[model samples]
Target: MEKTNTVITIGRQFGSAGREIGYKVAKDLGIKLYDKEMLDRAAKESGICQELFETHDEKPTNSFLYSLVMDTYSLGYSSGSYTDMPINHKVFLAQFDAIKKIADEGPCILVGRCADYALEEYDNVLSVFIHADLNARIRRIARIYDLTDAKAKDMINKTDKKRSSYYNYYTNKRWGDAVSYDVSLNSSLLGIDGTAEAIKRLVEIKENNNNKKL
Candidate 1:
């Protein structure tokens, strides 16, 4: 394993195999991978229950009920800044802080949760967006979950929309846009292993070039 502190952030569309690719990349690079485990860390760091993090994971809330119960949720935090924040915002900030701390620790692969935005200022961060054709995603989802094509399509669309809303709400950049990331790859074109190799190649390029211009 190469000794490097580069943090790779993956933004992926639903059923794009982004998490699988990230898993492969992390294994190949001998680094830690954070996905759902981040929720546990954030829950510990923010004093919020793990159930809440799971409930609001990659989900944005814009409801009157959020405002109504905001006070109840705010009492869990000692910080004044988080007092008036909605539950979703508190969750995001907790994850954001956890991401920064994770980056500070060393090399790791973070899938989704706007990790790129959280560590945007760090020179060692490499952000990638993974996407696949709609039909390909639908097929993959259907096969993986044993669902009808139409059901798979619907789930993909809804999940993607939720991720987009969560990302766009928290970050200034648009979600799933190529311009928002250092590099964008289509998993349908190269397959998961191939895409992972592509990202590793990009990492090599960045490492060789003094972490400038991937």
Candidate 2:
């Protein structure tokens, strides 16, 4: 792994081994990996319960109170509008704030919870999306959970839908859209270990002529 200041944010499909890849990337680079740990940090910082963050984790709420959503996802912030908003809005914003705070600290790997969108304004970020074909995902999920193929397929679809909705609802970018990320990988093509290695290469490449002046 190359040593650089880039913060890696991974957006992934269900059963795509995205978290595992993130762990590998973090380990390879000797940086921290933030997944559910990020929720803990957000809960502590915002004085919100960790359970609520867990319950709503990657599931979109029915409400859309834009009035308070922008207060800072405080991707940009003002405190007055943030007060008295719905709990869903608060949870998302808190996580958003947590993402920024984590990135500010240094290079690390952030998995999901719109971390890419949260740190879009920051330099030294490498946003990636990981996905695999439906059959591959179903097989992986089935083997992991000891489920029948049909059951695994159902679970995979539901999880992906939830993740897509949560991401699309919160960020301007569409979930799983290649255009939205700096790199998009098919985990089926390279397998998990190969995918992780690919990501390391991406970091090195991004560190090279990667001047979009980025």
Candidate 3:
């Protein structure tokens, strides 16, 4: 299939195999996938330390403070004031800019870090959310991490909470909501490869429809 200038942003629940699916999609499409690598790029581009990005990764902060920092960013930051801004705000903006820069580079698969919200205004963006049944997620996490079921379940809840909080805090929409994405899939139903193939089909359909309109 002829590739379109499309950017795929995937939002996923913890232990849903979303990252694996994203990798497969990118490989199948012969494109790059951005996950943790995005943080490296963001840190390099923003001149922030990479450790900070890791520390604040998918973590939420006070909404009011976020607004304040964003407003300061808009107005232009003085050296002293910028230094005083919350670290979470700085990391979020850095990642936000990195996401835009990545999209501008060309077709790619971006996993999480609110990539969909970051590229909301772009024309050729497809946002997808991946979720699975709780039991399935628990089993996947347990198997992958070599943890007991109880520990795996605990990690899943904690990780999902952070992701959801981060997404909701940064974007106006709710995380994991059907209306927030172009499509939401259950990874357990189709397995990792099948889910990736399904997303590829959606991308093809979207590209064809867009081409017809053009």
Candidate 4:
């Protein structure tokens, strides 16, 4: 299928092979995939240190910190406001701006960091959530991280919790809720490659529908 001017944003459970599927989809579509690379771009664009983005990447902050950041944003980005804002808020705003900038440039696949919410106003964006059976995720995590099953399960729980908290806090949307995304898929059902192919089909269908409206 020919590529369309669409931005794909993927939200996934820790061990659901979501990132792998995103890579495959981007390769098949001959588009760039933004994940960790987004942090670099955001840091450079926002003039914030790159390490700050990495430190707060997708991690939730306390309510006090949240309030301070929002207040600063509401007051606008004056020198005082920017200086007074917490590092987490600055990192998030930087990433949010970066995501929008990237989408405006062209079609690409963005994994996490609330790209879906960042581009919600864009009609050409597709948001997807990838999940898997807990046992399957445990096995996958264990194999990839070379950890015991028990340790893998712990890692999954912690990572998902942080992701959910961050998403919920940032977007005011429930993370992993089907209602929050255009489509939800179970990676365990079709494997990483199969899932990527399925997403390609969906994107083609969406593009066709979009073309019809034009």
Candidate 5:
């Protein structure tokens, strides 16, 4: 593994083999990889309820008047102190801070939670989207999670809907859309390892181009 000054963010469909791919890429790059661990850490740091974080984490956009909530949270106008901050606002701030902290640490791979959109303006960032065919995804989910085919199909649809809504709500862009990502892969075709290798190659090429300009 070689070190590079770029961070990779992956947005993936459930059962699309994104976590495995992201981990492999991070392993190959010798940089940290963040996923659920981020939520756990944010919960600990913010002193907010973990379940609230989990519930709202990567959740669909809220129509709760964000500006009003943010203003109240900012002014410390809840119960008494910032501790009185609404769970939603606290979770949002926690994740937002965590993202910045991770980026400050060094190059790494981040999965989910609209991470690509979070760091969209950063100079050294690569965003990826991964998806698989519906049947392929259903089968994979069924086998891995031990669910009936119909149940698996339902789960897939629900999960994707939640993820899409969450992403679109936060990013204002279509989920799994190629335009929002630097690379989009059909995991059903290439499989997890192949997708990782492809991304590794793309990262290498991108790094080389960056080096040339530097």
Candidate 6:
């Protein structure tokens, strides 16, 4: 991996306002913000359909199909009577490549898709996990997406479940575990802009040290 000034990867729970925090932090720091834009770029670079990538983005595969999934991934095809592997998984792999490619391009903020774990070993990377209380998350989702409270709650549960599974499967670390991240913030306590400011301060410290060493 090429040297970057700093790379921040945010792992966020649904409706936790983590994306908003990431966007604001990146803006304040004058760095590129990549969320869905990363997906679009991945699709273009890898020649994969964007819709297909979206279908598999941050979704966990059924545990029963673990062998098949790994086999298809490794052998490039299914070995059993099952139908050929879905194109979406292939597109996800492409997006994973694109994620790495994007990180290699320059410093940026990556939201979701286990980006923290993806660049785990890189020295200049900071992994952050943003979370909030259940009621707070539900209210935020309900207001933003115009969902009923119950529906918002359900959506939050399902989305977080998939994210946890996907992150755990790929990284072998507990999802949202505080120890897994450089910093974990409670968005409900500090609010979106406040969270962003805290992240900005951390980034400033990191950049200052990096500049001094150079």
- Order of all candidates by lDDT, from best down to worst? 4, 3, 1, 2, 5, 6
| Candidate order (TM-score) | 4, 3, 2, 1, 5, 6
lDDT of 2 by residue, 1-214 (tens): 5576889999999999999989988888999999999999999999999999999899976544653454435465457656756688789879999999999999999999999999999878999999999899999999999999999999998999999999988888999999989999999999999999999998888878666565
Question: Candidate 2 deviates by what RMSD?
Answer: 2.9
Scored by TM-score, the top model is 4
Query: Per-residue CA lDDT of candidate 5, range 1-214, in tens?
Result: 3777889999999889899999998888888899987898788887877898888977775566765665555664545555655566668778877887788789999999878877877878889999999899999999999999999999988898999987776565899999989989999999889999998988889998988999
Better of 2 and 4 by lDDT: 4
List clashing residue pairs in candidate 1: none
The parts of candidate 1 lying over 4 Å away from their true place are 64-81, 211-214
Please give the distance, in angstroms, between residue 1's alpha carbon in candidate 4 and its true position after superposition: 0.9
Candidate 5 local lDDT, residue 94? 85
- List per-prediction Cα lDDT, in the order shown: 0.90, 0.89, 0.92, 0.93, 0.84, 0.82
In candidate 6 the C-alpha lDDT for residue 119 amounts to 83
Would you estimate the TM-scores of all the predictions? 0.90, 0.90, 0.92, 0.94, 0.87, 0.85
Candidate 4: lDDT of 69?
A: 58
Question: On TM-score, who's better, 4 or 5?
Answer: 4
Cα-based lDDT at residue 104, candidate 6: 89
| Model 3: residue 102 alpha-carbon error in angstroms | 0.6
**lDDT at residue 106 of model 3 (Cα atoms):** 100
TM-score of decoy 5: 0.87
